[model samples]
Target: MRFTIGKLAKATDVLVTTIRYYESIGLLDEPDRSESGQRLYTEDAVERLAFIRHARDLGFPVETIRELIALQVDPGQDCERVDEIARHQLGEVQRRIAQLKSLETELKRMLSSCEAGKIASCSVLAALGHHEGCLHDEHGGQEVLAKPPSI
Candidate 1:
């Protein structure tokens, strides 16, 4: 079945602008237009958009997804290269998970120690005020107070 851009966006749960941008980027194919110039998409587009959205949700970058799609289109390639991509993505996810755990531990320590409701005695406030109290590294500690933590 064919669908309009709005229908495609609604179906995929992707923003209309994102869909257009993907088309513009060569990441997605440009759909045919109706007599009124409204974008018309086929069931194949629906499947492609679903694949793109799923890959994005998996935290795969657009560049990586583009490569994966290219790899998928080629018929003669072995499965080994696909395994390599999965491994690379897995390593990235694991690294991010580790970073998150560290942040979680630090946040738990900071939040648990601070008194929230009191006017003058907040553990968070104290930690923010004292440089040594911050768990960040030397340059990072300075950066966090001036600029918010990356997380």
Candidate 2:
């Protein structure tokens, strides 16, 4: 059955803009257009979009997802590269978890030191004011006081 872009988005539970982005990035194939110019998708598109969605949900980067898709074209290819990609992603997840745990510890320390006093005497504020008060020197190399881009 053919599906319009809206129907495809609804079936995949993905945003229409996201679908268009995937197409633009070569992650998803462009759909056929009717004489009146409506996009027409097929079951193949539905399945491919689902795969992409699942990969994205798992925090797979788009370039990595592209590599995975390229590997899919070879039916007789060995599965080593797929295994490596999954393992690398797992490592990244582990690293983020560790960073979060450190942040949690720091936040708890700051809160615990709070004496229910005024903002001037607040330990949390003190920590924010003085980065030396932080238990960790760095949070995954993130800035101690990051500056926002100029609007």
Candidate 3:
């Protein structure tokens, strides 16, 4: 059964633009076009898109996903490469977790330093003004900001 791009997107829970981008980048195969020029997709396309979506949800990079797809094309190949990719992704996740923990620790320390006094005397402000006050020096480079504590 052939499906249009919209149907494929709905089936795979991927955006139409993402599907197009995947095709443009050779992640997804160029699908057959209908008589009027509408893109036609088969069950294979739907399955491939689902695989890509699941890999993305797991935080696998596009290049890694592409490598994985290539691996899939030859089922007889050993899975050592797949294991290596998974291990690399796991290491990256662990590194991010460590960084996030440091950021959390620093943010908590900063909040505890706030004496609930006037802003002029706020340790939080002073800490923000001077990174030297941070308990975790490595937290400075993270882009994620902790939410303000409740009053």
- Which candidate comes out best when scored by TM-score? 2
lDDT of 2 by residue, 1-151 (tens): 9999999999999889889988999998989999999999999999999999998877788899999999999979899999999999999778877887888898899899989989778888889899887989976636323342211
Q: What is the lDDT of candidate 3?
A: 0.85
Looking at candidate 1, the ten consecutive residues that score lowest on lDDT are 142-151
- For residues 1-151, what per-residue lDDT tens digits would candidate 1 score against the true structure? 8899889988988888888888998888988998999999999888888998888777777888899889989778897887898899999777766666666677788898966678587778777678687575443222223432111
Identify the runs in model 1 with alpha carbons over 4 angstroms from their true place: 116-119, 136-151
lDDT of 3 at 59: 72
lDDT of 3 at 35: 87
Best of the two (1, 3) by lDDT: 3
**Candidate 1's error at 109, in angstroms?**
1.0
Residue pairs clashing, model 2: none
Model 3 C-alpha lDDT per residue in residues 25-90, reported as the tens digit of each score: 999999999889999999999999999988887778789999999999899989999999999999
On a 0 to 1 TM-score scale, where does candidate 3 land against the true structure?
Answer: 0.88
TM-score of every model? 0.82, 0.91, 0.88
